[model samples]
Target: MFPTSRIPLMGGLSKMSSSLMANVVHTPSILNSRSTYILERARPLPRIYPRQRKRPYMNRSTYVYKVVQQPYDRLMRQQDLQVILVQYVEGLGKAGDIVTVNPNYAYNNLLLPKLAIYASPENLANASLYKKSAEEEAYSSKTSKTLMRLLPYHTIPVVLNQDNEWTIEPWHIKASARKVGIHVLNEASIQIPGPPIRGPDQSLHGKDFIAIFKVNNKETIKMRCKIFIWATKPAERNSIENQFWCFKGEPVHPEEKDDLDLLPIEQFNPDKIIIPSGDLENTIVCAS
Candidate 1:
């Protein structure tokens, strides 16, 4: 027969289990914030990726090169040099006067032009012959006043330098003036306002630019000098007129009377497109 105690214990367990299961409402566990956070922290984190930029599309065979050119520093970088002047340099000294300057300036502006000699023992010995130029006499002469009035009206022709470069230097300008019968005794006196002219600018074939004549570094005269390009073939390009038409008694080109683009208008081709004085709207409508 089954044991009476075992049977009672089994019946009690069944009653307790049935009661616990009957009409039971299941609910989620209430947790403290720290514990909840810990549970959330235990979960595997989602992966994050960095923002990527797409490279520009190009052909695999394509190549690009960045060209870097040296910066231009007026070429005034040489050490100070002592030079004996053989002619008058306005800011510096007169003939036979020894002065110190940038070696670049001394070479390019003075020594090369035969305006000054290097102060070697041989040169110093012959320095006695380097008499001061009669600059006062030259300037005070009767023709100087006329020259001042006429210089601005004259066209200054520039040429391709010995180096085959188009960059016009002060010495180049001085030589050009000498060739054209204009006497510019000193390169130091020729002052261009901006970065040196590098041309024959096709569009600006005949143009006037301002030049400052610093006389004795005391008086400054602003003159409008016309720039003319000199080339081997005259037939290739039109020659710029040697003089402007503004001065009274100067002949004006009747053909260029209507042109306002280039001054001294005489140098350029005449404006041939004459606009008929009829209504422009009607003309355009008719053409359309």
Candidate 2:
């Protein structure tokens, strides 16, 4: 058939072809294995999220403050005063007398200047002693004794004006007594039988009314007084009783004259007397 040299050449070519086919198959398998190993070794990327910002919380019951304004002049004028005293001040009073004064004036003019001091217990006791001495001196005087004796004999005349009805108060008696050189210190010393004496009644007017005076609540002195109520014009003298002329020889009215002395004791009538209803038991009528 074929030639021996050509056969050997074909055999070498076939061997080369087979070797190349083997290399091509092995390369595809190696590439597939590498891709799988890389995929298994790698890790996934971490998740990313936006950050949230926080807000402050508000409360409902918070307190709010309001300021009030006042005027400067008004504040200055509202200064509170304090009470203090020391030695006698000309316009104020005697030593140990207590007084009220402005705080600023007291501190600056009195305390700091050494013009005065606070009224303490010791100073007040001294003042009481002085008051007692003055009272004792006044009681021992001649004027005081004369006033005491005169209370029994004196007849205080309370003249009623155009208004025939007059209210006789204890002070009215005191003021009337003062006009006649008598000084009544305590109003409680004078005693009236009824409520205040109110009258135009003929039984009370121009009649002897009794007033009791209790001196120091010990001695009881009886005073006989007359209340004269006459019209603006002169009236008949016979309209009044004989006792109206007891104090003076003549009547209060110029047209009238003293016609009689006090009535006789036997002729005294309890019905005609104007004594207080309460004093009916103690009252006694005596002719002078």
Candidate 3:
């Protein structure tokens, strides 16, 4: 009953849809003909999650540095600098002495300051005749390297005035050190790394405090110093026996255990003195 032209139009529509259905039925076979990787972007992606965070810089257990060591000769050629002192460079070397130093230090501090010169044949020849300057002459005698060797073993005693509100000062220590033949000429070089000892605190008495001393400009030396409050009263004064300036651990105050005596109050005895801790004696030994 339809017109011939309209019939062909309907048939064409049905034929096209049937072709689409056929292709759908064969979809797996068609896809198999093409590469599987094409559908998957490239290949199967790795098993990493969508977003991963990194550990904090400070919290990281591993560092990303590698050490590469070179030959000693190579390092000496590059990093080390040979110099001759035109003037004395304290802590480095004296004039006329050929010395090796850091390249940067040789350039900036020595060469730039005119304190030193490069080691040349002509300069090396003349270096031996150079005498130490006046300042160097004076200083060398005062602060000797011997002091560094001696100071570590001995505890320098600094006596402070009792009943005075004075805090420990460097000058008070310098005076005490000089008497013991330790040449601490400059008070500026001394530093107390401990808390201030103000007034006459009995708890602080006979306690060894650490003091740091700067040697030259480059080296540091540490010494132990015991601060003792000068006893103004006779009974409270340091006993003439058993302990000289300080007791073994703590001082037994006369009020606490004078005659009640749990601690020994042994009398001073200077023998031919084969004892382990013999009494300190003034002996006349004639060394012929």
Structure candidate 2, residue pairs in collision: none
Predictions in order: lDDT: 0.50, 0.48, 0.54
Off by over 4 Å in 3: 1-144, 240-288
For 106-202, candidate 1 gives per-residue lDDT tens digits of 8999999998889888888888777644654334332345545545544444444222347656787676556556677777998866656675455
Best by lDDT: 3
RMSD value for candidate 1: 33.1
Give each prediction's root-mean-square deviation over alpha carbons.
33.1, 42.2, 27.4
TM-score, candidate 3, is 0.39
- TM-scores for the candidates: 0.32, 0.31, 0.39
Candidate 1, superposed: residue stretches over 4 Å from native: 1-150, 159-164, 239-288
For residues 142-225, write the lDDT of model 3, one tens digit per residue: 334555555565446667766667887888778777655567767898886546668777676665565677776444666656
- The TM-score between candidate 2 and the true structure equals 0.31
TM-score-superior candidate, 1 or 3? 3
Residue 276 local lDDT, model 3 = 19
**lDDT by residue for model 2 (142-179), tens:** 23345455455555655554345677777777876665
